[model samples]
Target chain A: LAKTTQPISMDSYEGQEVNITCSHNNIATNDYITWYQQFPSQGPRFIIQGYKTKVTNEVASLFIPADRKSSTLSLPRVSLSDTAVYYCLVDYNQGGKLIFGQGTELSVKP
Target chain B: EPEVTQTPSHQVTQMGQEVILRCVPISNHLYFYWYRQILGQKVEFLVSFYNNEISEKSEIFDDQFSVERPDGSNFTLKIRSTKLEDSAMYFCASSDEGSRNDEQFFGPGTRLTVL
Candidate 1:
């Protein structure tokens, strides 16, 4: 498991694109970067995951550079419902435990 | 989309009382996990189960805490003696392949209020 660092909070307006970045400087070769979104009083929902390069899904997109030390989660055309906490986790699936940090609180205003 | 399900969306228990949180993972999933989130705190892993046994547990899972797969369809987490600090939201999740890139689907969670 690698410790991750992310902004404590971010503010955006509806229809704006939001990008949250996470830094995992000690990421291992086998580590995978995964992003999750958590609404209030709900469990975290998986958004996107990637080992390297870029990966896109219906909800979000993940971008990883060649170094793999950091990654960004991009949510296009955000809405008020998109306001939630975004967490970045680094794990290799060996222990199968998810270690969550404080995460970045994304506030989308209408 | 088959999703994990948990019973008793909310539970109120007195300190020192025993409580069991029940969960039904996805029908075809193999790996199960339990996690907790205190008010305004990060989600913390409690334990992971596979092959009818516990594969890993965090320091928070002590002798008072236990997990069981009583049958094919149900998984459970039992706390022999609850404490005030045990008040939190517990989430159940399951992964199908349990590989490096496997996705774990999470349930709505049970909010346990220990008083």
Candidate 2:
């Protein structure tokens, strides 16, 4: 499993774009970068996933550089409800075990 | 969109007592998992069940913890003897299959408190 490192917390204003970056220097070739959003007292929800380059979905966008050592989750036009803990997970297919790091707590303030 | 559902949103039990957490995964899904998150901590995997058997499990799942698909629709996690440290929120998730890109849908969770 690739260990991921991210900020403990971040603050952003409503309508502002938020980008949370995760570093996985030991990412394997078969590993895929995935992001999950978790609100207080709720299970983590899948937001976006990508193997390389950019992949956009209705909720968020994932950008992975060529090296695949790092990836960024971009949330456009954030709202107060968007305040949640965001986790960047690597290798979701390895025995279906997702090792979670200390996630980035995004506080979207009004 | 279909969602996974768990019963007894909250459970309170005494130490050394037994407790069972129940979940009903999406009708068409085939993979089931159990995860727990202690207060002020990250989510940790407990076990994964597929085809009515366990495919994988983490160290957190010990002899005291067991999972079973007792029926066609119900998936259960039984703790033989509860401990104070076992208090946490247990989440149930299910995926369509074992494919790489399959997204796992999660239930709200069952908060277990052992006194």
For model 1, residues B1-115, the per-residue Cα lDDT tens digits are 7889998899999999999999999999999999999999999999999999999899999999999999999999999999999999999999987676778889999999999
Query: Mind sharing the TM-score for model 1?
Result: 0.97
Collision pairs in model 2 = none
Q: DockQ, per-model, please? A: 0.70, 0.65
Task: Score candidate 2 by TM-score against the native.
Answer: 0.97
Candidate 1 overall lDDT versus native: 0.93
Q: Each candidate's iRMS in angstroms?
A: 1.6, 1.7
Candidate 2 lDDT over B1-115, as tens digits, reads 7999998999999999999999999999999999999999999989999998999999999999999999899999999999999999999999988665667888999999999
What level of docking quality does candidate 1 show?
medium
Chain B, candidate 1: TM-score: 0.98
- Single out the weakest 10-residue window by summed lDDT for candidate 2 chain B: B96-105
- Fnat values, one per model, are 0.66, 0.54
Report residue B109 deviation for candidate 2 (angstroms): 0.2
CAPRI category for model 2: medium
